[model samples]
Target: MFAVWGLIVLAGIFVVIRFTGLIDHMLPAGDPPNFTFAPETPVPQARNFFIACPPGRSPRTDRAMPSPSFDATAATLADVMIETAPAHGMQLMSGVPGGKPGRLYFLARTPVFHFPDWVEVEFILPEQGGDITFCLFAQSVYGLDDIQQNEKRTRAWLADIVGRMGPSG
Candidate 1:
């Protein structure tokens, strides 16, 4: 009787996963994406940087790529800090854009409660010729409790970074 019930439940789950299109929608559509993490180099000055984005979103596209833009409303940096600051409110002391395509650097103060009392973010535009290597790091931070609590928050940061992509080249 138990085996029969288990089979029935399994069949139902399979039907929903297959017929409901959930499996197709949830599965990744392309090759695995690469994310890079590099310590800032001199000239650029040594600092921490990570790049994360989904597959098919690389800078190598021949398709007409739209210049990146910042979120006008809640997705703005200020909005993001407002949402993320209490748990890890870091002051954004300075921000500079790279001369190339869309590179950006941010200096932020670490919340009193968190480790590494300072965190810097440097995001380079794919158009400038770079691979996205920071996605793995973002995933790791989301996995670790000491860094970020939820992956969604990390994703928000990624979105904000992507949002900062420039309008030209």
Candidate 2:
């Protein structure tokens, strides 16, 4: 029993080292993520990063700075809508189907430095595609006291979005 417990502890340590990117240099190029959820959504194929759940607890918004400014600088309008936003962590990047001409709004929580926490994204795409609106509302927190809460929040938020979208490319 003592030997088994020792082995378990060692295995746990190994897993942590692997997770923190320490063992990456020794591994070969990994196969792309075989996503069970969104088989059609195109994931970046050439990266060697592991998938990690977002930290659930809220960020330290009380000390966080304000949102940053985002600009749409693509030649084509569609390019402006989809491609450009996520590059800047614009959560909901999509085209509008009806109503409204063409409008884009970028939003984020305090401390634009730590983006992806909160955002308000929108754009119009004529009469075919529906308007896209991504509104992320999160806070940044630090220390061990809030870790569990933060992680829970992140997972919940991600699950909600994925649940609604079904899957993506």
Best by TM-score: 1
| Superposition error at 5 for model 2 (Å) | 50
* Count of backbone collisions within predicted model 1: 10
For all predictions, the C-alpha RMSD in Å is: 15.8, 16.2
**Candidate 1 global CA lDDT score:** 0.34
Write candidate 2's Cα lDDT for 1-169 as tens digits: 9999999999988787666655444432222122221223333232211122112221322312221112222124334334444443444422323212243323222221232222222232224443232212322222223333323443444454444343332
List where candidate 1 sits over 4 angstroms from the true fold. 1-88, 93-114, 117-119, 126-147, 150-152, 158-169
Candidate 1 displacement at residue 103 in angstroms: 5.9
- Residue runs of model 2 more than 4 Å from their true location after superposition: 1-144
Poorest 10 consecutive residues by lDDT, candidate 2:
48-57
Please, what are the lDDT tens digits per residue for candidate 1 over residues 1-169? 9999999999888788766656544542221112223322111111232233334333232211222334233234334443453443333433323222122222232222122222333333334443322212211211123333223434555455454442223
